[model samples]
Target chain A: MKDKSIKMLKTIGLGFTEPLIRLFSGEEPAKNGKLFFKQALLPLLSIFLFIAIWYAGATALYNSEAEVRIEKARAEQGEEAALAMRKCIESGDVSCQPNTLPSPAQVYTAFKALWQDHLSISEKKADFKARVADTNSEREAQGLAPITYTGRPSFLDQIGTSLKTVAAGFLLAVFIAVPIGIVIGLSASLRTSFNWLIQIFKPVSPVVWLLLVFMIVKTVITDPSIDKSFIISSISVGLCAMWATLINTSMGVSTVDKDYINVAKVLKLSIGQNIFKIVLPASLPLIFTGLRITVSVAWMVLIAIELLAQSPGLGSFVWEEFQNGANDSNAKIIVAMFVIGIIGFLLDRIMLSVQNMMSFNKGIA
Target chain B: MAILELNNVSKSFGAGSSRIDVLTDINLSVREGEFLAIVGFSGSGKTTLINLINGLIFPDAGEVLLKGEPIAGPGPDRGVIFQNYSLLPWLSVYSNVKLAVDQVFPKMSSSEKEAHVLSYIEMVNLTPAKDKKPSELSGGMRQRVSVARALAMNPEILLMDEPLSALDALTRGSLQEEIIKIWSRDRKTAILITNDVDEGILMADRIIPMTPGPKATLGPEFKVPFERPRDVTNINKDAQYKRLRNDILEYLIEVGATRRQVSDQKYILPDLKPTMPGRVIFGRKKKKDKVKYF
Candidate 1:
């Protein structure tokens, strides 16, 4: 028995020591590392390849259309037609000109110009601050006017606003939905009575809800006490986002294992204690999954809300730029698209990290 | 004094036309510090019997007296160890045991409570796995955690429902030894519901064979007068142990055969194909199948 105890201690000691040694010494990567990379490589490569193909196709279409229009102009209207086309192209109104898509080179030039302007704005802001101490009157007269030279909201500002709206809507949904869901789930009669209402409301279109919310915000909140646009847009997003969490929480609580309930009964646990210790822990995995789905849905829906409500978010920025027909608009659109994608990905990763921390056993694959 | 008494206990489910009786006219008494094993085939009301004792389920017509008082509902006085090792998978072995200890010993100092829980965990030989969650622990280890959790509560009675049935034979044997050692030390009133005849014979001071449902009832109660701290290896050497074991086995065999015969009668067998010239039959033939002089 003594030798067995010693052996057990040695094994446990090795378990702790091995990881530390690997970390400090930086040995060859573990076998699982190769498997992890193998699993991830295909998806990463496919995404990159798809984007490359799309860029190539768009470039080809634009170049061929431009070539056709130039040839037609040279043949029918003489050398003057060529000059007129060049002016239109320089003016960045390629769509107004007949049959010609803007070349990829034009798009790249527009993107670089916008990027340089954004850098200049930051520099200007810094210079303005330094000059303000010396010549306050002149700077006050010049007063910053929403940095309109860029012709579109910078990629960072749009992403930040979109994220803010999503965060607010998600928090509001969590506050209202989870407790109500739990109550409904715990009582069979209540669940039966309320299920019809949930079913009816859950499948309703977010656009219809958005329109209704806009009307309500317009008529009822007359004092202009808040940004009515933000309020309407958030409520719209929340309306769509709330259902997933509500359904998930209800299912999670309802499916809590009978054995745990029996244990609670045998222990004579108080109602509050049972809810906190047993029911909540057992339901966490499901609840987290629901929250994840809800957050994603809210994010996707928030853009639609922004576009409709003209809310100052990534969605509205993308919409306005698309309508304005500016030279740099397409670049801004691409930037906005990538920003939304990355933010959504990050949100999921954050949730995953939190879920991992909350779980007691690391055995869940 | 009788720690528990069941008088004319009967349980039934549903009502009117759909109503079906599960147990009827059951009578039994358990004295303080007695270890009793209830044995039966599948579908027997043995689990229902334990549930009734634990107050998880109510009897349709009966009185279940615990310490001379009728049980009202599930309470900490009767801690139950479930067959599935229902230790909350989210909690570690130590935490699971500690949870019970904390509830039952609300006034104890934190250290005292910790020590109490740890002692029970040690008794079950799960001290090394104390920090491991149910999902991380082996089946035998998880069951040990359940046992520790129940024992840590220090209840007057421990109700177990086939607690070791899911374990492999070797693990079952080891756990049985551990449980016996713990029972000997505390002498708490314990009622174990199991389908294993050998398990009932090995652990209990008395083994009560139960028949199957509907209206299942105790068939016979066999007394085991083996010496204290009986080892499984040497248990067969005792004449009384052998006699008691054989007796219980005989009752189980008879009950099992009767149940099988009733089920077999319900099944419609397909017409048999003609036997091949080279095929040989096995097992004892029916009396009517005697050939030639036989």
Candidate 2:
């Protein structure tokens, strides 16, 4: 059972955990200790090396800039003024180089603060809900519509909103591309006709698609009250992210093993039955790979689209902080950068597990 | 009564000058519960011929008839066990067998269908491996699953395309025995396409040699007079088996020798001396280019 657990961990692309698990199980302490040292310790050491380099570089650059500022103050006023200016930069007073790259500590502090802000927002929301519950009942008694909370979405709420937008766009792309891809893949004439269009539209970047979507959304959706930015961003994401899925699904469907199709034909499966029972199942691995890529592309592009459209999401928060150009804003932006990277990593992992569950070659997945 | 018949069936790929005929002037019939094997080299178009019977493909000329009626497309009446054992890698052994049973025998009660699937799995002696996927099973076990899947459908005819060709010699021999055992009990009309001569003789009631390709055609048939449930150990002692094997092998040798002789007399291209660019790129050979043989 200990051996099996190690195998399972390795299979999930968590090979680093295998050595650790083995060490705990006391199966091969010496061997696993060496493996644990090699796999786990080495990567951690490299990360520390990277952080040390970054910290040294940041401290040197900022101190030099502060020296220049202090020298100018001394030239203009006196030694006391220069000393005070140097003290300001050293103590991390927000007035000095607000847009400077944050040291690791600042980023960590920002992360903690962001969590606290989210927690306070949650409490405020709960308080709002409690206050509204009695009023809502009274309003119902008087046959009036219940009042709604009118507050800016919190940082966590923005993360949730971003996730929702990406999910919506991704699902739409899947529904549109997979059917079209299957039809194109199965028929030569259909593929030929669509090939030119696929070639033309596939390379069009998200930014370009966003501009086109902006025009269409402006003309089509006239209601100013609706969350038009969210809709626009979602549609733009769908347009840009769809090509990967379309190409992969087609390639996968077309290249399904000939023997399998012969088996399907020998079984006298209907066209619909053939697609669902044989084609889809056989092509799932490639399809999921395409979907995972599409989700990542959607995520990378969503921030830009959200920022441009001024949608209330992380993209806007980052953009807003960058514009604010305050000392803490730099650290907050750094925090957002890590959040995006971690979320992208998580999305890929979620897709991998889904692929593993459905695919025949589960271990590879 | 003839359960399956093919008349003047010719299949060719490509058109105009590029056209190559695969099957030509093929007229054949198999009686009910007859075991017919077609022996040939790989890429001999025997698979194409089998596909015609299964209605996996259409003949350019003439027809393939199942019973009195023509076969339009493949159906539950004809279950094919493909050369690759085309079981879905995603499905377990039970699911692979149950896929056919569920589709072809939709009217069967769920309990009845489950029982039927189990019975075939048990027949193939794969009860333990029934929950395992094809990838987990060995080559011999996968072939058994394929056999079990085909048999579970309980079709009027069973078509096998070198189903045991991929297994090792030992496994092949054992599987041949297993197949023979299955045939004796079920007595389903079957066609076995194989390159292995011994395997053909072992499993089939009638062995037909297929001529070599570019365009392959059926040569001659040898009927096996060996009694039912004959022991493999007694094959050497059985004069009929030895005689039949010799006759088929002799016929195949003659066909091969004839084909080689014909190809030898065909037009041959003259070997040109290396061109200026070719000499420069490849570096000139020291030997004098003198070839005057016809």
Candidate 3:
């Protein structure tokens, strides 16, 4: 039972827990202690060190920017004006404050503010929903459109939108690339002919893809009810990120062990069975590898695409915060940056775990 | 009547200057219920021969016939136990055998198919590990799964392409006996390709030695006079077994040496050195003045 749990943990990319589990099960304590220190505690220490460095850097930047502002005031005006500028800056006036980089404490405060904002928005949404419930019912009875909430999205809502968009874009990439990859992979001639096309399109910028999608979607999708930015951004992300999966799938398909093919032939399996049973299973490891790359690529390009499309996602949130120029705007932007990074890391881990599950060979993952 | 025949079958690979004959002018016939062993050195076109019979690859000249009908392509009628144990790694032992059983016996009921798969798994002593994937199985266990998969197809002619070569000696011997036992039940026409002369002598009704290639061909056939249920332990003491083994081995070594002699085309490389020989030392020689060396 314990072994099974260990295997499960290892499959989920949590092999660091193996030593902990062993120690708890009364295995060698000293050995497990060393392993735990190396695996878990060391990484925790590094994280703390990273925050310390960031805090130091942020403080240094703030001090230098403040000095520059005081110096500028002294040069432009008299000594009295410079003294007043220093006093204003010391009093935490938003107008004269150095807002170049936000400290770690400021970022935490910003995170708390966003959380509070989200809570307030949720309460407002609930109040609005309750107020409109009777009218919405009456409208539904009369076959008329219902009232809806049209307020600005909160930080959490923006994150939710980003997640939804990425999911849709990833699905689009899989749907577009996998079958095409299979077909191209099966035929050497097709692979050779399409190689130029793939090479040309694989490295296209997400902004260009968004513009291309925007051009087509604007003309084709005339419905105002549909979110045009969402569609445009997702399509762009899909187009920009699908190349990894496409290439990997084809390579995997083309390089399936010849012996397996021979077995399929001897069995007299039909084309469909040959592909699903023999070909797909054999190339699944490679396909999963491609998918993992696709997911990461999709995520990396999504922010740029979302920003260009004007979708209310983390990208838009970051851009808006940058332009807001509020006292805590830099801190909020830093928070968004960390959220994006942590989410990207989590997305990659999820892909890896899924890949490990699909693979029969434990060593493949 | 012969169940399977390779009539003047010749196969080659590549074209133009790169073209080389893998097998040429090969002919053989196996009667129903006969166990035939084609023994040869490694890379002696033995796999090519088995592939031709199984219809995995076509012969460049001549035809492979099954029951007087020329074989067009591979089918379940000729089941091949591949050299590398081509059991699908993603599939468990049961599922691997079930895949062939499902294809060959599609009309069979689900329960019947399950029974068939399980029976073969039992036959190869892999019933306990039936739920385990090929990656989890050892080399011998994997080969057993391969055997079970091929047998589950119930092919009229069984083709084995050095199936036991990858296994240890003990596993190989036990598998040989198990195969013979299985073959005797329905008396299937089995063709075993192997490099072991003793294996050929122990398992086959007729043993045929293939000479070494670029254009490898079959030599004279030697008949194994041993009876059914031949014991590997006691067979060593038999004078007949020793003579047959020696004869086949001697013939293989002789043909192999002669082929090597004829095919030898040594090239004389040009005697050349670097432009700055004193400065550039090659092949583990350190220069006196400089520290760097190749």
The models' CA-based lDDT, in order, is 0.81, 0.86, 0.90
**TM-score versus the correct structure, for each prediction:** 0.83, 0.89, 0.95
**What residue pairs clash in candidate 3, if any at all?**
none
- Name the runs in model 1 displaced over 4 angstroms: A1-37, A67-117, A124-153, A359-365, B15-20, B260-294
Model 3 ranges off by over 4 Å? A363-365, B264-266, B272-294
lDDT of 2 by residue, A80-171 (tens): 99898888877867776524577898889998988999898888888998989999999999999888767867778999999998988898
What would the per-residue lDDT of candidate 3 be over residues B195-269, giving only the tens digit for each residue? 998988889999999999889999999999988789988999999888988898899999988887886678999
Residue A39, candidate 1: C-alpha displacement in angstroms: 3.6
Clashing pairs in 1: none
On a 0 to 100 scale, what is the lDDT of residue A196 in model 1?
96
- Please provide, for model 1 over A276-310, each residue's C-alpha lDDT reduced to its tens digit, 9 standing for 90 to 100: 99988988887887888889889989888899888
* lDDT per residue (tens digit) for residues B123-216 in model 1: 8888888888888888888888898899888889999999998999999999999998898997999999999978987899988988877778
Which candidate leads in DockQ? 3
Worst 10 residues of 3 chain A by lDDT: A356-365
Complex DockQ per candidate? 0.48, 0.43, 0.63
Candidate 3 residue-wise lDDT, A36-137, digit = tens: 988999999999999999999998999899999899999999789899999999998878899788999999999999999999999999999999999999
- Candidate 3 chain B, poorest ten consecutive residues by summed lDDT: B285-294
Candidate 2 segments whose C-alpha is farther than 4 A from its true place = A1-13, A67-92, A97-99, A143-149, A362-365, B16-18, B264-294
- CAPRI quality level assigned to candidate 3 from its DockQ score: medium
